[model samples]
Target: MNTMKKLAAISLVTAALAAPADLTASARPARATGLPAAAKGCVPAMIDNFMTGAYRSPDLTTGSVTNTESGAMLGGRRTTRFQVAGNPFGFPSTAVVAPGDKSLLAVSSGYKGPTALAVFYGLRSEAHPEVLRADLSCFKRFEVNFVANDLPLNINVEVKSASSPTVYQCGVNTEAGQTNGFRLEFPFDCFVTNDPAHPPVDWTRIDRVLLLIQSASAMAANDYAINFFRLAS
Candidate 1:
């Protein structure tokens, strides 16, 4: 799991879902002070260091976030491949740029455990499992930096491993109208494992990262927005 940081820090969360229900959205790899010490041969695999904005973008778009990049990654714009339950999935999930000119990524998800996900297809080759894990080894933790408003009053972030089909999820306690930058950390241990044959997380081929929001407390407020994001440490 990743270390959730607000203001690039955390204030001892109350566990479980908390506070009021407000998706009036707004929007952590490490406490990366500045860049990195040097470009490691691969994505920094430093367990002690949170690598942010230091990895190769490969084909990174100009935008700060990748909510819109999922379509291209999965070779489709709207998809039902990520849903675990709640059949009769709704129409296309949306990724909208909020006010302040590309300020936030506003993602509108459907009811019934709405999930928004994007895959970085082939970012790491399955041909080299050893190489893949070695490259991403430093990243034992995962967290996102964002401002929470109206979206997933009770939030869970899921990551699908390449080795298994189970979607591992960790609950995040989101604070409303929080432009102060809240982060939910999901470490490897936090992911639930139903497959005994393969590990819950296949670091070598991490596949896709999905944002599964709890059914919106208020349907109208299910959609949410965030300032930006960071994947590091």
Candidate 2:
């Protein structure tokens, strides 16, 4: 979808949130962005443009029979059940095949619901029991390029590891959403892991990654559209 349509999605989602529980494409709340330039020593583990089939449901990858709010597939996507949710404000969400008639992933924080879906990707490591893993030791940072409804906002991200109880988490700010769209980048240390040992990030043992959003805060806003993503070096 073009930037205009993407921005308009915010209105659609807002209207949807203001209305009934069930939302339609014509008006719904939900969306997810882009990256910046490469930094030195950045090694990409796995990046998907949604153009090619890279991620799928955990079931398809692990051959397990558990039902999660799955939408991480090569050709499929998911729209959040809630158009408006969260604490102070409602946030509708979506994880669908973006570009609507094409083959790409679309994530949204259009609403502020506490519940959001996960698009699982990256490496899988038995070393980390449940989460996925990757060796990011070679790199120092990661970045992604996505469309932004607003640049001054922050988006949520989580990196899971097998070595500790808490996952690496952080809030990244959006870039210029009008001209170049949004690009966000951050170093490994920026992510806060509850383990005081903060045991060395088993870069090689990274378990899994997820794209997340709160949907809304104290106010309402537009949604974002992602175009490309990568872990920079």
The top-ranked prediction according to lDDT is: 2
The list of candidate 1 runs beyond 4 A from truth reads: 1-94, 98-102, 108-135, 195-198, 218-220
How do the predictions measure up, each by TM-score?
0.46, 0.53
- Residues 1-233 of candidate 2 have per-residue lDDT tens digits of 10111122233322322111111112211111122222332223335555543333221111121122223321122222122333344333344544334444444443332323333343121111232334466666666666545423445455655455445665554433444465676667677754557664555555455454323323434355566555655
Candidate 1 lowest-lDDT run of ten: 19-28
Q: Give the deviation of candidate 2 from the true structure as CA RMSD.
A: 13.5
The ten-residue window of minimal lDDT in model 2 covers 58-67
* Best TM-score among the predictions, by candidate number: 2
How much is 142 displaced in model 2, in angstroms?
1.4
lDDT per prediction? 0.36, 0.40
